[model samples]
Structure formats: C-alpha cells, structure tokens
Target: MGKASLLTSERRNRSARGTQVRRERVRSAWLFLSPLLVGLLVVAGWPLLRTLWFSFTDANLTQLDQAQWIGVENYLYYQDGAFYGVLADPDWWNSVYNTLFFTVITVSLEVVVGVIVALILNANFKGRVWVRAAILIPWAIPTVVSAQMWLWMFNDQFGIINYLLMGVGIISEPLAWTASSSLSMWAVIIVDVWKATPFVALLVLAAMQMLPSDCYEAAKVDGIHPMRVFFRVTLPLITPALLVAIIFRVLDALRVFDLVYVLTSNSSSTMTMSVYARQQLVEFQDVGYGSAASTILFVVISLIAVVYLYLGRRQLGISS
Candidate 1:
C-alpha cells in the first residue's frame, strides 16, 4: 500500500477497536445492573401491574383470588352510563380538591417561608450552627408523631393553642380546630408547614452556602442593595436547586396520607387522595375501586411531574 493508504487503514483499525471496547464496556455495565433491574421489576413493577389489573377488576381483600375483570366500571359510567363510577363519587372529588388545595397552599408557603429561613440561617450570626440544628428538629420528627402531637395541641377543650388565643383575647370561646370543617384543613396545613418548611430551608441553605462569595463581594463593591443582590443574583443562581426542592415537596403534599389520616381520621374536609384510596380499600373493602383511585392518583401525579419538568426545561433553555 502507498503511505496515505497505510495511514488510513491504521486509523480505521483503531476506530473499530475503540468501538468494540465501548460495546464491551456497555455490555459489562448492563450485566452488573441486570440484578438490580430484575429486583426493581419484581418489587415495584409487579405491584404496579397488579394494581392496574385490580383497578379494572372486581377484587376484594377477602376475595382477592377471585378477581374478575369488569373493564372501567370501577372508575366511570357504571349505572346505565349515567352514574359515574369513582369519577362521580363526591367524596373522591372532594379528596382530589383537598389534595390540590393542600399541595398549592403548603408548597407555596413552604417555598416562601423556606427561602426566608434559609436566608436567615445562611448569614453570619452568633450560634448559627446551633440554630441550624435546632431548626431541623421539626423535620426530624416522624410525620405520624408530629401529627399526633399537633392533634393534642389543637384540642379545643384544653389545648395550648386555645389557651394562648383566649389569653390574648383573640377569641372569648375556644375554637374547635380539628373537629370543625372550617378549621380542620387549616390546622393540618399548619402542622405540615411546620414539619416540612425546615426541610426546604435546609435544602435551600445548603444551596446558598455553596454559592460563590465573589458574586456577593462584587455586588457589594458596586453599592448594590442587599435585597437587590438576593433577588437578582442569589435567587437566579439557586433557582435550579430551589425548583428541585419545591417539586419534591409538591409530590409529597399531593399524595399526603399519614398526617391527615392520623390527625383527622375520616374527616371529609381533611380527606386527601391517599386517605381516600385507603378508606376505600381497607375500610370499605372496595379493593377494585380503591385501586382505580390509586391508579388515577398515579396518573395525575405523573402528569403533574411531566408538566413541571417540561416547564423547568423550557425555563432553563433545555432542548430535550
């Protein structure tokens, strides 16, 4: 071969070898990951498939073995195509509305309150370490334990909340916080905000701490106001991390079960999507209907996540 032909053949051989090596590496990685993938398929995938199947059938806890497919009757248009199945169930709709409302209010409050708390904690102050640790106390508390604790605190007859309000002359009579429909949801929201805001704060504080000090120094040198520096510089840089934290809290709040269940058990006003599904499954023994609700909840959450991610991408100028 000529000099140019020899060099070209060598380059081709090298490229082929590189491609083979990459293929082998990818195969090895997949081989190592196969077990974990199989485990996930068994653990998560199987149950999801089972739930989907049950959602379309007449399954019951007692007669689970005798599941018989009855199409979408569990979900909609059951009686003469007039009475909606779970779709027309007022309690289910109420639970959905409660979930959406709780998600919006709690997440909004958490984000705003968390940003403030993070900013405070991020500053140089005496006992800053202790204060940061102390703020995490509420987040560390178990949700059920926190719910129960708040439940007692909200007791109208002898709760500390009532006592303080009465002492301050805010109200002459003790208000029923949990039992009253008007107050029950707010009471739950208060407890959730207390329990979760610290977590969001911690996340934001970590993000804030990682930010380059040069930005602050440059802004200071330019005579920029501290508030302007925050909104313009600090907020923009930490937007990604803050978005992730908000999304996590939103998903958690959407499917909330333990706090509402433990705090207000069966209260129509406080019933969330998760609690509603459980009530149908365990309490009413309507497994099929409950599974349908569970499926719908999953679809709703998935759609919300997709929309959120799409918006995030659009805002961040991501193509895919």
Candidate 2:
C-alpha cells in the first residue's frame, strides 16, 4: 500500500513538472513571436484600420486631411429613388466578375500544368538540373518587365506570336491579342500561366522530393502500375502541398493588379477589382469610394481564405 502511494505521488510530481515545462515553453514562444506580431500590427493592421475608417468618410485625395464622416454612403445608400454607390455601380460589378473569372481560370490552369511539370521534373532524366533551372526563369523575371515583353510580343502588326500563328495556318490574318475584347482576357491568362506555373511546380517538386522513396520501391516490387500507384499513394501524400499551392495562387490571382494593368491599361474587359479601386483613388480622386472598394476586397479575400482552409482541413480529416 505504501509503495503504491509513493508511486502515485512520484507520478503526480512528474506530471506537475511536465505541465510547468509546457507552460514555460508556451511563454517563451509568445515572447519570441511578440516582435513579429507587433511589426505586423504596425505595417498591415494599421493601414487596414485606416482604410476601413476612410471607407466610412467622404475623403478625397486633395481634401483627405479635411475629410468628413458620411456613414456608409460610399458603400450603398438610397438618397434618390434608385440605389447609388459602389454596390449599385455596374462597372464595379463588372470588375468583380472579371477578377473572379481570372482567379478561377488562372489557378486551375496553373495547378494542372504545374503538377505535370513537377512530375516530369521529379523523374530521373538527362539534363534534369538544367531543365529545373530553366523552368524557373519566367517566374524569376520582374512582373513589369515580363508584362512589357509580352505587351510587345502581343502586337498585331509585327509580333512573333502573330507571325507564328499566321505562318502555321492557324489564322489567315494577324490576330490582335491584347486589343480585342474577345482575346484580351485570354492573353492575360496565357501570360500569367506562363509566369506562375513554375512557382507551383517548384512548390510541388519540393513536396515530392520530401516523400519517402520506400513506397515507390515497394510498389515496384509488387508490380503495381505507375498510374495506379500514383493515384492511390503519391497523390494522397502530396495533397497538403497542393492545397498550399492552390491557396497561394488563389490569393495572388484575386488581388491581381500589376499584370492586368500593364497588359490592358484599364481596359473595361480586363480591369480587375484592384484596377477599379485604383481608377477611383488615382484617376477620379474619390478616396472614400476607393477605400470602400478596397475594404470590400479585403473582406472578400479574408472570407475566401478562411473558407478554403476550412474546407481543405475538413477534406483532410484534420481537426481545427
């Protein structure tokens, strides 16, 4: 009886020590993370709060300092019989449609092509190292520079793209890649896919490289087909990495501004949410209206990210 009691006491003491150690570790972790938390609050949190504030006011570029609060007038109001503000604006809705379309198409294409490229790169082949290096060249180039280069290449009069298409009997005449409403969006998508596929491939390749080789060896010994092994074994293992790639790509595509702006230059057919906000803020000098649009964009992105992570986690059977 005495021995059992003593053992129980010792076990209790060890558990207490373990609890204390865990507490100390958590405290230390928070201490280390405080600086980064503070920096984010200063850099991102402050600007976001400021934008939210500006959204509720009648602030303009020239009179920003002397702005007046007007409630949610910039967002939506019904002073007249008809509705007004950003929510009711046709152009704003058009931009929203364009942004969503771009995000979906680009992300889907990038994932498919990136996975294929990653699979190819993962295979043992001659000049594998050089091929990997070359694949990343498009992603490494500056966005503005790449957009400008594509801009010139997309010229209908004298461009390599048109020349090739014409020479190959694809089109009888030189097609206007960027100028036409029908083809402008496709042009942007093509450029975006070309540039961003390497990023996704790199991510997926890293994930693939980390996978255990023993699985493949065992599958080979069992005489399992490569496709069957990949679907049943490899794809499931690499899904988490794919999720990460998809989320990152979605975020970038949703907030796409630079590439579209550079390629189309505020064209109605291809103008995204970011470009619409820019037009309001810079061109029209409607600070309050632009802030409202920017705030809506922030809310949309946050909701999408949250929902995506939730769905992804649920699919993976991971507990929050």
Predictions in order: lDDT? 0.93, 0.95
Q: Report each candidate's C-alpha RMSD, comma-separated, in the order given.
A: 5.1, 5.5
* Candidate 1 worst ten-residue window by lDDT: 76-85
Candidate 2 residue spans exceeding 4 A from truth? 1-35, 318-320
lDDT of 1: 0.93
TM-score of 1: 0.90
**Residue pairs that clash (backbone atoms under 3 angstroms), model 2:** none
| Winning candidate number (TM-score) | 1
Candidate 1 lDDT over 155-261, as tens digits, reads 99989999999999999999999999999999999999999999899889999999999989999999999999999999998898899899899999999999999
The best candidate by lDDT is 2
Question: For residues 82-108, could you state the per-residue lDDT of candidate 2 as single tens digits?
Answer: 898999999999999999999999999
The lDDT, on a scale of 0 to 1, for candidate 2 is 0.95
